[model samples]
Target: MIDLLLEMFSYMFLVRAVVVGLLVSLCAALLGVSLVLKRYSMMGDGLSHVGFGTLAIATAMNAAPLTVSIPIVVAAAFLLLRISENSKIKGDAAIALISTSSLAIGVVVISLTTGMNTDVCNYLFGSILAMSKSDVNLSIALAAVVLALFLLFYNKIFAVTFDENFAKATGVKTGLYNMIIAFLTAITIVLGMRMMGSLLISSLTIFPALTSMRVCKKFKTVTVCSAFVSVICFFIGVVISYVYATPTGASVVIVNIVAFLLFWATNLTIGRIKK
Candidate 1:
């Protein structure tokens, strides 16, 4: 396995994918804990869907995909947050509204112009080859910013996640922190959509956090465990995808699903033992 990994990493594209994927996985895992607890886990999905729409439009216009997609998706993220916070459309309903609309637009645009070619398929379903050198560089920079900000604001994020109203009462800026979370999540979704695709990117956020929560009660513990689980599963999934010629996004999601079930079973067994 070590030898295989070394050989795989010898390729520049694979290295780019691994480097960006791992960073995106870490960012997604870290933010996912709070998002899941806040019932905003679907934000990743919504942003990725928005990303696809923008990417499709970019493709049609012969423009840079990331340049076109990033700002649009970030705007969509902020829009989703405001709608959830202010309007009658709240939580999953808000997410679903943005998600379905974006996905439909993307599908129509792609069908009209690109017509579901290999590159478009890569964006929709993820391919290791999806990350170009420029994409990797951009992804790395954005992912680092996401990680650094998350660490810097960890305490505030924790407060907002557990009790937003109480955090607000306690003089914490709950709304700002929530927007920060959404902004970071939107970036991660776009970065990861290269390797995990629009359809499967959210799994990188949702699975590891949920899996860790099954056994780890503390937020810090769950965050650390989720990071580990996400990176390991991504590595395994990449190896499997390479060897079996499977879709990178689907393979990663499958590995995450297996990990979640195992953690759930372990939690149940521990509960039984305690009883």
Candidate 2:
């Protein structure tokens, strides 16, 4: 396995994919902790669907995918929050409505413009070859911003995640922080979608948080564990996919699933021993 990964690293595309994946994993995991705690986890799914629609439109228009998708997804994220706050459509209903509609639009656009070729398949299932040098550079810059922002606002985020009303009462600007979270999440989703695909990218934002929850009790501990787990799982999955010629996104998700199960079992065993 070591030899195989060393051989795989020699390829430029593989290196780009690895770099992008690791950075994305870290950003997603960091944001995932807050999203999960706040019950906004499905936001990532909805935003990824929005990214799919924007990416499809970008492809049809022959524009840069990230440039087109980023702003649109960011707008949709804010819109989703506004709708949730002010309209009858709330919570998961708003997410589902937007998610399904965006997905449908993307499919229709792709069908009409590209006729569902290998590139379309790659968008749905993911392709390591999709990570160009420019994509890696953009991802690195955006991922750094996410990490820095998260660290800068960690205390405020913690307050909002656990108790929005209380945080607002304490004059923490809950709405503004929520928007910041939404915007950051939008960026992470779009960045990840290139490698994890529209359909599976949310897994990167969800699985790490869930897996860490199985073993950790404190919020900070869970957040730390989630970041580590996400990065390790992505690394293992990428290597395994390269060695076995499997789908990269699915392989990463599979590794996450296995990690979650192991964590759950360990927690259960510890509980039983305590009894």
Maximum-lDDT candidate: 2
lDDT of 2: 0.92
lDDT of 1 by residue, 1-275 (tens): 88988888889998889899899999999999988988888888989999989988998999988888888999999999999889987668988988899889988999999687787788889888888888888889999999999999999999999999999998998889988999999888988986899989999999999999999989899999999999999989989998898998999999999999999999999999999
Q: Give each model's whole-structure lDDT.
A: 0.91, 0.92
Residue 69 in candidate 2, Cα distance off native in Å: 0.3
**Model 2 lDDT per residue over 1-275, tens place:** 66887799899889989998999999999999999888888999999988888889999999999999999999999999898878987878999999999989998999999888888778888888888788789889999999999999988889889999998987889999999999999999999997898899999999999999999999999999999999999999998898889999999999999999999999999999999
RMSD (Å) per prediction: 1.1, 0.9
What TM-score does prediction 1 earn? 0.97
Assess candidate 2 and give its TM-score to the true structure: 0.98
Question: Poorest 10 consecutive residues of model 2 by lDDT?
Answer: 1-10
